[model samples]
Target: MTIKDTAEEWEVRATETPFKGNKTSVRTDDVVMPGGSVARRDYQVHPGSVAVLALDDEDRVVVIRQYRHPVRHKLWEIPAGLLDIPGENPLHAAQRELYEEAHVKAEDWRVLTDVFTTPGGCDEAVRIFLARNLSEAEGQRFEVEDEEADMELARVSVDELVRGALAGDLHNNCLVVGVLSLVAARHGDGLDALRPAEAPWPARPFEV
Candidate 1:
């Protein structure tokens, strides 16, 4: 369908500054639906984000463990973050986050997939990247105030990563999807053979 025919037209009806100080902007709108029905909705359009599934020479994938306050738990995840400034593309953001969060830099980069984290409620989208040719670097650069990310970089077998996803051990959906897409793109039907048997994720935190 064409954009003009399928797109929903929206007009802002009113706005209210519910809170200030944080970098959040809440917007309320009233729109006329395609069937000539009127409806009101609220939206929070955040800046887009990027994530990386970095691989090393030994065929090990980089994974990180960090405390997530929202979930009130520490979880293993691929390196990722939101774009703080406007006009930053996913590749550049991915490269920056690799160094900022994991203290590593990649010499080569490839786009794995683009995902909408929650299209129904938010405008947040994340670009997943495959990073390789890694080298050690310095410390992380966190953006949020009172933010403390004690990151542990681990090298996990791709097979174990997939298995973790299947067993519901890995909680991040984007990370699972990104790694699987990269595996499929590289090995076609042979991806299953690249997985290590009885692989386990790193339980300790380490720098690059």
Candidate 2:
């Protein structure tokens, strides 16, 4: 079947419950079908987010191993966060997360891609960035005292990271997407040369 744009489209009829903790909203919308049928639909809109892919002098990607409360499991992920405040750009939020979560600062930064985490129901967007020329900095982690999480920094070959992601070893969507994009942009079609055969990690995750 061929889909055609109709002059009568969706319109927001009403909105209720402007705010909820997370993953919940109440909205009412109106739609006019091509056959002159009218219908109403409710929606839930979520917020946007940012993610960072940091690279150090040794060409090692900086990653954080943190226990995600929602997932109820410890997983390796890149530094990322939601835009808690209004009108905050994703790149600035990413820079803040990099320093807060990893305690590292980048001298050079570039936006790799912008993606929608889930488009069917929520209006969430994730902006990925590549950070280079990293240096030691102070961590500004989440202020929640009850949050159970400890961070460890690991340096792995780009190839190993990609393999781990495909194997479900690295499950964080933001990290996998951002790092892989950077790897592709850096190496083009010849990515095998950058993959590592084994894990090479530092004694701990701290300022270098």
Q: Model 1, 11: alpha-carbon shift in Å?
A: 5.6
Q: Write candidate 1's Cα lDDT for 1-208 as tens digits.
A: 5553233446645555443334445555676677767677666666767788888898888888878887887788898987777665556677888887777888777666667776666667677777878998756544433333366778998889988888988888677897788778777644333333112212111122
Over all chains combined, what TM-score does candidate 2 have? 0.72
lDDT of 2 by residue, 1-208 (tens): 9994333335544446645666446555566656667676555665567788887777778887877788898888887887676665555677788877777888777666667775555656677777778988854544533342456667776778888988878878887887778767767743233322111212111121
Error of 1 at 101 (Å): 1.5
- Segments of candidate 1 deviating more than 4 angstroms: 1-21, 138-147, 187-208
Between which residue pairs do clashes occur in model 2?
159-195
Residue 202 displacement in candidate 2 (angstroms): 39
